[model samples]
Target: MDTNLSNYLKKEQDKLNELLSAYLSKLSMPPLLNHSTKYSIEAGGKRLRPILMKLTCEGLNGDSEKVYPAAMALEMIHTYSLIHDDLPAMDNDTYRRGMLTNHKKFDEATAILAGDGLLTNSFHVISNAACYSDTEKVFLISKLASASGLEGMVAGQLMDMQAEKESISVEQLEEIHQLKTGRLLTFSIVTGAYLAGADSMILQKMERFGNLIGLIFQIQDDILDVIGDSEIMGKASGSDEDNQKSTYPSLLGLNGAIEHKNRYVKQAKNLLEEMELNGTLLEKLVDYLGSRNQ
Candidate 1:
């Protein structure tokens, strides 16, 4: 990563951590629910979604502070998804971010409620954010609901589960991830740009940019699963193959997957230039995504 980008990422991640802790501290949920939710949040992966949101806003010269609540909400939804994804009924993983998975650290029921609380509370945070107009609140809430609900990640998760242990074409795999992973990622970008007062044309292009970036991200994730170190990744490698899940490497070979990701990376950078965002943090971020280890 560029030194500037690296510093910015670390700074944003720290801010997000403090924001989450402060917000959760203010909530009045049950003791266990609060603890379980905080446990998962504190497990601490890259706060990619919120970072992307803040970066997009800053790249547009928008007031980054205006998006703080939305950024927090985005992270909460992301953490909720991870918590549920690690459940025994989902990926059945025992660890995440080098720590016990939510269900492993706490019981399954508590984990379930933790995920639920985060997901639901995300909207509450948005709706109550006084910075946005009522119209903006409705827009944020609706977009988030679609992005994280049945039309988005949840639907993608179902498709992923159904496709497990089954051979799927590359297009099919992309479709699964486009919903399951891409939507929320896209949400981070589009919402950030929209709140930054980007015009409809720019928003459309950003949406496309977001989708391409999402594909690039998922492609890299697929690549990492095949070759990543468990200690570095903070999760077991080869879990996809163990589960017989289809991935870029499984279908395209490792080299082919790299080539495919490069194609997207190039297109993403090109799209940034078209948006006149070349030489910006967003462009640097595309490079970071191409080479991310985890």
Candidate 2:
């Protein structure tokens, strides 16, 4: 990874961490509820969605701070999804980010509630942030909800679970991920551009970039699950395979998957070049995604 990109991402991650901690601390809820919610959100990992949002804002010459709450909300949604995804009825994983899964660390009920708390609080945070207008807040909330609801990640998860009953095609797998993971990722980038008041052309380009990045991310994750170390991924390798879930490497061979990843990486680079906006950080980010070890 480029030192500059690493440093920049670290700085933003730190700020997001502090903000999340502060917000959670202010919750006047039961101790268990607060603790469980805090545990999952504070689980150590890359705050990728929020970082993408903030970067989009900066690349558009918009103040990233203006979008901080939206970024924070995005993280909350992501954290909530991870919590739910690890439940017994779901993937049933016991570890994440090298730590016990929320349900294992806490109880299942608490974990469920914690996921709900995070999900519900996300909209509140976005709508209640001080910097953006009520109109902007409404738009932000709508986008998040839509992307998170039946039309987006949840819909994708539903398809994924159903597909596990049998086998699925590569195109079906792609569609599942496009909803389950890609939509929100796309929302992060496009929302920043929308809030920044960028032109329609700019927003369209960002949508394309976000979609490709989302696919690249999922593909890399599948590749990692096959070849990655548990110590590095902080989860069991081959969980997808173990769960009988389809993935890029499963559908395409390992080498083929790597080739697919490379193609998207190239497309992302070309997209950035075409956009010609704040190229340095974005370029480094795309490169980092392609090359990161974990």
Candidate 3:
């Protein structure tokens, strides 16, 4: 990474971490629930979704502060998903971010409740945020619900599980990811740009950019699962194959998956160029995420 881009990313991530901590500290939940939830939150993943939101908003010259609450809510939803995704009933993973999985750290029941609390409280945080106008709050809440709920990540996860049971075409695979992993990621970009006062045309283009970036991110993730080191990844690598999940490399060869990701990267970078964001930190993020090792 360029020194400046690396510094910028670190600075934004630090701010986001503080905001996440502040929000969690303010919520009055049962002590155990609070600890379990905070444990996962502090485990320290890339914080990619929230960082993307902040960058997108600033990239459009918006007051990035206005998007902080929404960004916090977004990370909460993502963390909750990870907690559930690691459960015995789901991926049954034993680790995350280089530590014990939530279910392993706490109990299964507590992990479940912690995940539930995070998901539910995410909406509460957004709805109660005083920074947004009523119209803005409604927009954020509704869009978030659609993106993370039945029409989005939840539905995609279901399809992914179902795909594990049978063969699926590449087109089918794309549809599954577009829902499962892509929706929330897209939500990050779209909501940030929306709050930044992007015009309708730019919003449409940003939506497309977000979708392409989502695909790029997932494709790289699948690649990482194949070639990544468990220690660096903070999880067991090749667990996708062990779990019988359909991955890009499973459907397409490793080289083929790389080609596919490159195609999306090209399209995403071009979209940035069209939006006049080609030389911004957002553009650097596209390259970083495309080839990220962890």
Q: Please write out the lDDT profile of model 3 over residues 17-50, one tens digit for every residue.
A: 8877888898788899889999999886788888
lDDT of 1: 0.91
Q: Give each model's whole-structure lDDT.
A: 0.91, 0.88, 0.90
List where candidate 3 sits over 4 angstroms from the true fold: none
How many residue pairs clash (N, CA or C atoms closer than 3 angstroms) in each of the candidate models, in the order given? 0, 0, 0
Cα displacement (angstroms), candidate 3, residue 182, comes to 0.7
Pairs that collide in candidate 3 are none
Q: For model 2, what is the C-alpha lDDT against the true structure? A: 0.88
TM-scores, in order shown?
0.98, 0.97, 0.97
Q: What is candidate 2's lDDT per residue for 45-155, written digit by digit as tens?
A: 898888888888888788777878998899999999999999999988888898999999999999999999999999989878999898998889888999999789999
Error of 1 at 119 (Å): 0.6
In angstroms, give how far residue 290 of model 3 lies from its true place: 0.9
Error of 1 at 140 (Å): 0.5
lDDT for 262 (candidate 1):
99
